[model samples]
Target: MGIISPGFFGRRRRDVPGLPPGQHLTEDFPVLSAGPTPRIREDEWEFTIRTEAGGAHRWSWEEFITLPQEDVTVDIHCVTSWSKLGTGWRGVSLDTLLDSVESTAEYSMAHSYGGYTTNVPVADLRDGKAWIVHQFDGSALAAEHGGPARLLIPHLYFWKSAKWVRGLELLRHDAPGFWESNGYHLHGDPWREERYW
Candidate 1:
């Protein structure tokens, strides 16, 4: 795994002042790095969550949108060395989603397109540090940037905030995600600068 040094927290010339303290900024914000966006119809968009037992629930775009939404300000650290500070996002909390499904799993993983996945603890999920984001900077998410819905994890490295997130898979054990399997750090903590193993 590789370590990242985002030039945030007033460390970078372009750093903004809206984020909470101790948050740093990364060099670049690759809005379209994942490539061209996909064409997804609202009628076809579905978000599902499954427990290890395979018991699952699905949400149509309409149903998902019907859930309560909240405004959040979080710091993001990317594996590529860029941090977006004080990013304003509006979306449903993981707890809200879990409560909707009445989840029982103690741990969880988020899976997205491009074979991307990230492991997370239920405690993090319940802490309001994450969200199924629909809007960024007060605008609807663009596809290249994981539109429709993406997971926003403030505490962990940005990769943990999986983009183009299709659903969350509840797990009984912790499993490494795409980057994790590829030598990226398991737990990316910015304060200690723990970007890799």
Candidate 2:
């Protein structure tokens, strides 16, 4: 089943400052999920990075949290036309997590806890552009919003930031992920309004 949000066809407001083209500012964050929320215990949570060469980098929840953390404040735009501005998040940068791993892959497929997956360019995941966020709005992220951890790629449409992110598989070639295979844009740039294929 596809992810569903209540205001998918809500009226767009173009006058709002900082909103992308065809987007409206929203004060409340909406919950959209493709399936039932999985309740994962912190101790059982593990994140892995699998390389194209079949090597793997694994991090348990205990080890993951000890890494460097950064506080981020950025605007998030959803393909559904709602944009939330100045959202605060706390997480470890993808650069830090990927520093030791070596890959010539140009793309990555993010795997999430509840079987959600999204494709992203390796370049977009580096250089401090993305994060593995565990906290939102100064608190532990809520389960409905991908609590324990989620991939945060603010520059792209929100769906690219897969919720409940568990691991990332490096791919030498680009592959359409869950949404992309379902006709969502392969590169979901909010500014470009690349919502559908």
Candidate 3:
């Protein structure tokens, strides 16, 4: 993506700087979810990031909007052979959410209201690497595509960037997530084609 910000990890490792290996680019953003869509009202939404030892930061839908926000253009690669390029999103950076929390956790387990969880290295979320997005293409995100808010970590396979995100639990050690525990790779990198363990 030409709009990729400086110091993005995916850019640092590649020369071609386009789609990852084994993924075909697509313009249409597909709607994929593990189960039925959950309709969440804005007044009832909440997001939290907590450390295993107990420090936590939480925001309601209203509070979340008051924090700093930015627009991002990214190329997203899904594990199912589809890559969507030049996707636009608006949200708060994960860096902001973890700013006040004092913790030394190296891993994070993203928890969704629907009981879905995905794990990722905490380092991957800092310094503009990840976001919790509520808007897509300048419009409010649809319920089918994870409304209210969803984690967006474009560097990894889309599954790692979970939908319907509600809270994040920082961990001292690495752990497999839903798909990872069920056969998907622990660390999914589309370029390496790490779709499964």
Candidate 4:
């Protein structure tokens, strides 16, 4: 047999900075889908945003891809105690998505294609706070990891990122989504140890 490779026997800790409380560093991004991955082709994909006032903004795959895009690098912390640092992504900023719309709504709910929903503060998703990412690490995001597009709000726990993201709904009040309704923290802040009901 060939000689064994060095550093292949176990996980080594990286010098990741600003990790939230109770989180361990991980170099590899883990897969943690809650349901079957939906395979959406570029032609069949669409994104919509519905405001509480009943106005809807929609985008088709072709149109969505044509929008201005940006690249971002951030550290993401999952509620499960794993944090991945310096993850790279390319997508439209939430600010870009909300630019034309004007509203006093205080909360935004991200709705995913597979019926996954996660709510967050409207402010948290604006001012360069979040993104709707279609590519990660220079490749199209894989299905299991929220391919086609996913919301990336790094400041909050990973669950707020909303994998397989499809749209956003604006509301005057906070509304809990899947995990939130099921006992996960309504506003998950890793550094604050906000992980449960």
For lDDT, the strongest prediction is: 2
Tens-place lDDT digits, model 2, residues 1-197: 57788768745534667788878787999988888998888999999999999999999998999999999999999988888999999999999999979988999999999899999999999998999999999999988999899999999999999998999999999999999999899999888889999
Against the hidden reference, what TM-scores do the models get? 0.81, 0.92, 0.90, 0.91
Candidate 2 residues lying further than 4 Å off, grouped into runs, are: 1-14
Residue-wise lDDT of candidate 1 within 59-95, one digit each (tens)? 8889989999999988776666667766789888987
In candidate 4, how many Å is residue 107 off? 0.7
Please give the ranking of all candidate structures by TM-score, highest first, separated by commas.
2, 4, 3, 1
Off by over 4 Å in 1: 1-28, 32-37
The 0-to-1 C-alpha lDDT of every candidate, in the order given, reads 0.76, 0.92, 0.90, 0.89
Against the true structure, whose TM-score is highest? 2
Q: Global lDDT for candidate 2?
A: 0.92
Structure candidate 1, residue pairs in collision:
6-25, 7-25, 8-24, 8-25, 9-24, 26-82, 26-83
Across residues 87-191, which tens digit of lDDT does each residue of candidate 3 receive?
Answer: 999999999999978898999999997898999999989999999999999999888888878999999999998888999999999999899898999989888
Candidate 3 matches the true fold with a TM-score of: 0.90
Q: Candidate 1 — number of clashing residue pairs?
A: 7
Between candidates 1 and 3, the TM-score winner: 3
Q: How close is candidate 1 to the true structure, as a TM-score?
A: 0.81
Worst 10 residues of 2 by lDDT: 7-16
Error of 2 at 131 (Å): 0.1
